[model samples]
Target: MYIRDKKTSFALVADKAELDYFHQVSVKDCASATVYSAYCKMTNDCPAWLQAAFWLRDKMSALANVENIKGFHNKKPDSPPKAGEKLDFFDVVEISEYELILMSSDRHLSVLIAINMQSNEGTSKNLTITASVKNKNFFGHLYMVPVRPAHSFIVNNMLKKVSFK
Candidate 1:
């Protein structure tokens, strides 16, 4: 549960005493993409398989009365989202030139997703995604049983689709 080599604002959430689950993934060599643009690519242009996975996830979550997250959109926004705006299912927590932090909370759990961009000597950029969860009840713990592994797989696929320029 610790992320090394990368300094991330995610540490704030990771340090929380109630942290129940945590995962981080990164993609390198994205020289031309900004934090907002990279996020748009990962979400707006989601592949068919990942879209289907979202569908399945929504259906399963509904059975347990968990909040249903909106599926990825095909239309990309012309501008970056602001703090008070909504980005898919998450509320925009903070958005800046090099970082975007989003969150969603419900009766079961609160989830925070942070996307951080690091410039490597001005030649290339690295994108790191960190997901932190805080389970509020038994259902939250149970929900993550399947979600933990699936989250890593899904994020890897999404990261691969992020267009550099």
Candidate 2:
């Protein structure tokens, strides 16, 4: 974790292997030290919204510390390296036709995810889909699919709460 040209023209240094490990991070790879140093050097502490913008920018910069990997978004490590909220993939409960969202960590992270969702205005993040159950089998199983001609699974990012996290 090297910070080039820090305050007073002081450059910071870190171990190469440590840097390499952090480079290949999942949500779990971020440790307390990483989160602290990653976010501590901020120059702004403005109103909520503006502060959020800066925090996200810092996150992007911190990504350079993480390793690049394909399908990294799709994978969840068994143990979390850092302590923060993360949105887990939606789990489709086969029979219920409803899903359980795997939101872990604190509410702030959930709010962040939901905020990110609404910012896109119904793009990328498809939080919920509208569908009907059909072809119910004798074994009490029903299929939930978009059979209606005009149907949309809209993501109401604003309504989503991160309290579960």
Candidate 3:
């Protein structure tokens, strides 16, 4: 997947080798591509580049609090090997990770490991992002800016104005 010069984005589907490394970091992060897409769609605008940025900034700054991951991975064996200890959650599961290429009219911020998957040694396309964001807020904010290319800086400015509000 690749992003064009237009107001659009690409789905970075990694391969098996890349996925292994991505899964390592992804196991900890809470951000999901689906959720991000929905948040961007809320803007009802074009490419959700800016929407993604805002979400990333907020997520990176906020402390990660993930639940059910341990349970999802695999339960430890008890002293007596309790009964009904199976790995069902891991059977049907999904992982979300991506490197958003924020290409604005001027500045282009690449290598943004908001969702891990830092290593780029392999050459496969296993991961994919199905971007279909509708709107961000249920009730849209009048002055709310649409997700654009050059808005990460603006989002940072606003965030700095009110830290963790």
Best by lDDT: 1
Residue-level lDDT tens digits of model 3 in 1-165: 222212223332233233211111122122223322322322223235544554554454244231121211122222211122232211211223333322111011111112122222343222222221112232222112343333344333322321112
Clashes of each: 0, 4, 14
- Give the Cα error of residue 123 in candidate 2, in Å: 26
RMSD to the hidden true structure, all candidates = 3.5, 22.2, 17.4
What does the lDDT come to for candidate 3? 0.26
| TM-score between model 1 and native | 0.86
Please list all clashing residue pairs in model 1, or write none if there are none.
none
Positional deviation of residue 99's Cα in model 3 after best superposition, in angstroms? 9.0
Local distance difference test scores for all models: 0.78, 0.22, 0.26
Instruction: Sort the predicted structures by lDDT, highest score first.
Output: 1, 3, 2
lDDT of 3 at 12: 25
Query: Ranking under TM-score, best-scoring first?
Result: 1, 3, 2
lDDT at 129, model 1: 91
Model 1: CA > 4 A from native: 1-8, 11-17, 163-165
lDDT of 2 at 3: 32
Q: For candidate 1, write residues 1-165 as lDDT tens digits.
A: 222224444533446455798888888876436888888777776778777877888988999987677587777668888997988888888899888888888888888888888888757888889888888899889889988988998888778766354
Residue pairs with backbone atoms closer than 3 Å in model 2 (clashes)? 23-65, 23-66, 23-67, 24-67
